[model samples]
Target: MFSNAVKCRQIHLIATSIAHYWPLLHERPLSTLTTTAISQEPSMFVTSSIFIILYCGLSLMLCWCDYQSGLLPDRFTCPLLWVGLLYHLYLSESTLSSAVWGAIAGYVSFATIYWLYRGLRGYEGIGYGDVKFLAALGAWHGWSVLPQLVLIATILACVTLGIKIIAGRKRQVLYNPLPFGPFLAAAGLWCGWQTLISPPP
Candidate 1:
């Protein structure tokens, strides 16, 4: 009888415990629980994170190479352009037609500016490599954002030049060639991150 009573008491405690916790469990919406579960898991964002890292690594590498050598190698720029197309094609993040048009526009616009500047100044104001780099950026971001990207890069480059002139670091700003690739790379990376976080509608 004592043993039976003890078992009954344990059962009663278990029931009470369940009753106390049941409201807490039931009160949580399934969506809230699902969200919490998803938040705790990092694998869901692994692919996006990898892509972001790859984009950043490539952009930084190009930036460094341009700063050090004043050249943007076709090896890097071409691969970046192709990969961007492939990214959009396979990922379906954007239409392949858009990427192609972007690349065309990017190249033509910059090349036009390059030739016009040369015609007016009798010298090349921009390198061919910079043109290719901008094309690669367009491949990744599409033509929609190209204007903003160029504007940002131009603003950044102008600001840097202004600072250098103010600091008396560059006496002959026109004579001293400034590599535009780094500024373009920086702007591209910024736009890339923005695209990754919030894709275009």
Candidate 2:
């Protein structure tokens, strides 16, 4: 955990204390509270939705911080990932080995593509941020859908490039680093859902 995260957590604690003591504080609960007002239990979908929203918001902030500070801070990213992986491991206890291998496979697939680009261009093609994101995705969803992620990312990039070309915004076929992480993550989720709903041979 990063130092800033520690400070942020402390601030949150103080705010919670203030909110708790202040009877005037009245934040509406979005879902039915369990047995107590302080149960801290929302509907599962609501909780998942909030988590996803927070992840995207944090990812945007992290991306901006990376652009500004030239470094990826672990404050938000690491804890969320660690907890997510544990959640995943617990949910798929019988397939823990598959998840571990899937993570490795996802990393290898993406890293291999990354290296291939580097070799052909003789320059740094992908950044460590992308590498880490892919690794995290691997850990989250495993490797079975990694190929779909790559395919979808490529199609999205091509479509983006096509639009740029059609609009006459640029001249060269420059392979700019777009936010491929989101597409990969989204595609993996879609494919994973499909697989879960329709198991195959």
Candidate 3:
């Protein structure tokens, strides 16, 4: 329910914070930096830690909001997508073209499935928010990681559904709408973290 102006302000703050702190996060040799270095340069270490904490915190907020409200506001998803693109652009870890294509492919793939499902079933089977969330993830990780990301998310969601049905002890549980955002967020976080530690070639 945030106003557009408020959302813009928030995104600006986040972008500025990242621009200020991100270089410190990568300033050290991640593979070689040790406890001695961390103790010597606590400010740099703490700033880098804060950046990741904020990143994960924002993602968790999105997951919680989606689960509770069944809505993924453009405020959160748009910033996520744009920040990811900017991250790669600033770091040059991946081509801008790759990130752009990843975003497009992610959005289009899910959007197509969403429409097809609605067309055949006469009702929405997938939320538009999920499409946006996936696109944000793609912007962070690129298209190559999407298949595995989706597969992991699907399995987690299915397992959760199965557990729900069993706990309820009812076959009718299949009709209930389950939120998929949490699973997607979990998978996205894992994939993103992996890429951060060991970037793709």
Candidate 4:
């Protein structure tokens, strides 16, 4: 009788333990849910992060070169242009038609301004490299970001020129040929980040 009573108590304890743990066992874990979310959209996050890093690094390199030599070489700009086109082709983030048009529009618009300014002033206002840089950016981010790039670059360039003018009387001349590459490159990177992080409607 005692053994039977003990068996009954043991069975009751087992049942109580299972009841206590049942809710936990059935519940979904936070970590599991997080993992599932990551799995669902892993490509977008991973590719975007990689592109950001690469784009920023490339911009920095261009800025440094321009700062040192007031020049933007074809070596860097050419690669940037090609890579952007290839990236879009492979990823389908944008149509090839859009990228081609963007590249053409970017180069032509800047070239038009450059030639017009040169015709009136008898000197080039912006370099060929600057035009190529814009073309590359447009190809990568599409024409949508071009306006933002131009606006940001213009504001930054104006601010920089203002500062140089203010400091010139007290100090040496800032630059004989002011380098617009850094400003353009910085603006392009910023606009690219903006587009990548929060795509337009």
> Highest lDDT: which candidate?
1
Superposition TM-score, candidate 1 onto the true structure: 0.73
Of candidate 3, the 10-residue stretch with the lowest lDDT total is 44-53
Model 2: worst 10 consecutive residues (lDDT sum): 192-201
- For residues 1-201, what per-residue lDDT tens digits would candidate 3 score against the true structure? 469989999999999999999887887566356866667567644544554555576578889988898788888888888877775675555466777788888899999999999999999888999999889878877888889999999999889878877798456555657788888889988887776443334
Write candidate 4's Cα lDDT for 10-119 as tens digits: 99999999999988776758667888878856776676566666667777777889989988888888777777777667556446667777788889999999999999
Task: Name the top TM-score candidate.
Answer: 1
lDDT of 2 by residue, 1-201 (tens): 699999999999999999887654443333334345446334434554554555456556555665465444567446535544654554446555555676677667667878898999987566555666666555555566667767876787678778888988665545444555555545555554654332221
Candidate 1 yields a Cα-based lDDT of 0.83
Better of 1 and 3 by lDDT: 1
**Cα lDDT of model 2 overall?**
0.59
**Number of residue pairs clashing in candidate 1, backbone atoms closer than 3 angstroms, sequence gap of 3 or more or interchain:** 0
Candidate 4 regions with alpha-carbon error over 4 angstroms: 1-44, 93-95, 169-175, 198-201
Q: After superposition, how far is residue 150 of candidate 3 from its true place, in Å?
A: 0.6
Per-residue alpha-carbon lDDT of model 1 for 94-191, expressed as tens digits? 46778888888899999999999999999898999989988988888888889999999999999999998998888667667888999998889778
Clashing pairs in 2: 102-143
Residue 26 miss distance in model 1 (angstroms) = 24
